[model samples]
Target: MRPAAWLTWGALAFFMLNLAALVGAVLVNSFSTRWFGTWWPEGFTAAWYAEAWREYDLFDVLLVTLQVSLAVVVISVLIGVPTAYALARRNFPGKKLLSLLFLLPILMPPMTYGIPLATVLYKFHLAGSTAGVIVANLVPAVPFVVLTMTPFIEQIDTKIEAAARMCGARTSAVFLRVLAPLLVPGILAASILVLVRTVGMFELTFLTAGPDSQTLVVSLFYSVSAAGIRAQQTVDAMAVIYTASMLVLLVIALRFVNPTQLVTRLKDPAQ
Candidate 1:
């Protein structure tokens, strides 16, 4: 085979190998009754999952995780679309500054925003609520959505919008009928990116999420923290389930948006 093909195959093999190893490690720990210094599990069992399902509140945390992630998706799309349009289509005073401002959360450390954001949320009585989580989460998501959607909006022919206006298509109608269909790819890309990020978020949720609103990651952290190595196997089981769920979501999201279009959305504006 050609050198490029050989390299591609080599890289893919390396990745799959690592992925398999990781899966095996988690699986062995999760399914084994005892995992010490041994190279392999002495026996396999479903007790961890059984305990988790029958006794633990993993399902509650999972539900909260779903709620927050979905809220982030909706909030990101609502807020990001207009900002993306403005950034992509117009050149105004402080345009660069405005762009940078939207990006502050993405560039800044979670602690930087989380500290002050928590205080503010407390003042508003939303500190431990879903709305608070959505607001804090938007720090990462809005910028991501804007960044994803900008390129797609730029690629769309502006003259089509202008012509639609000339033909008596109001601004709302143009966006609703003409631009909306073209945005499907970018929207899906942004939604998936936002969903994955929101689901995996730890620090912000760790700090702000109340017991009633704790996400899976935060709950898992507490579970592992409280139980120590004895719980490692169970934690591994939960991680495996979480990873599998995310993988399924990513596959479904991929089916909605092609890699080419997703890449196009992330490309440099001039390209």
Candidate 2:
């Protein structure tokens, strides 16, 4: 191989090693009793997990996270799929500009729009609640759904819908019976991606959520930075739990959705 190729591979390997080491350290520390100056902790214990579960009120936090994620997924799918159908079936003036407008929310950083969005929610007395967090998350999620589903809808033949119409099918029936069955793969992919994004989203949720509305990620942030004396192990344990939850969700999602196929559909809409 060329020297540059060797150098590139060497750098990639070094980056992977560092990432693995950092994750490994956190995983180990989550279970460690103490390690002031040693290669490893003198002992291991699972008590930190319990302490974190209690101190962090992880059950409630996780419940809120689940609720927020699920609500975003359902609402985004309902709103975005129909909007995508319209764009797919119709050619209208300013369609290109409208699509670009949809793309902006997904392309821009959450913090960029989150402040204004939060301001709007607060003005309407919706901020600092579960509904507010859901609405904030939906801004990016719905657009993501539209973009992901648009290609899938485009790949579908219009003749199928025409045929359904010929069979005396109403517009609603055409969508429910004909288009929906074929769009399952796209819907599942978009839903899972949205769910993951909601779980990880911090800025929007943080800006909109109250004490009772806080999700797992927000609670984790507070555990790390909020003023108080807390055990490092407890915080590490919470991190582990967060990581494990995401991994488990991904694993389950992958069981049904082929990520490579999803990416291919997103990248090559004509396909």
List clash counts for every candidate, in order: 0, 0
* Alpha carbon deviation, residue 152, candidate 2 (Å): 0.6
Q: List the residue pairs that clash in candidate 1.
A: none
By lDDT, who's the top model here?
2
Q: TM-score per candidate, in order?
A: 0.87, 0.94
Please give the range of 10 consecutive residues that has the lowest summed lDDT in model 2.
Answer: 262-271
Name the lDDT value of residue 264 in candidate 1. 59
Q: Cα RMSD to native, each candidate? A: 3.0, 2.3
lDDT of 1 by residue, 1-271 (tens): 9999999999999999999998898888899988788898889999998776544477887888999999999988999999999899998999878877776777788988898889988888887877788788888899889988877798899999999999999889999999999888778878987998888888888878777888877777877777764467777778777888888888987787776867655666322
Error of 2 at 195 (Å): 0.4
- lDDT score of residue 225 within candidate 1: 79
Write one digit per residue (lDDT tens) for candidate 2, span 126-160: 99999999999999999999988887799899999
Q: By TM-score, how accurate is candidate 1?
A: 0.87
RMSD to native, candidate 2: 2.3
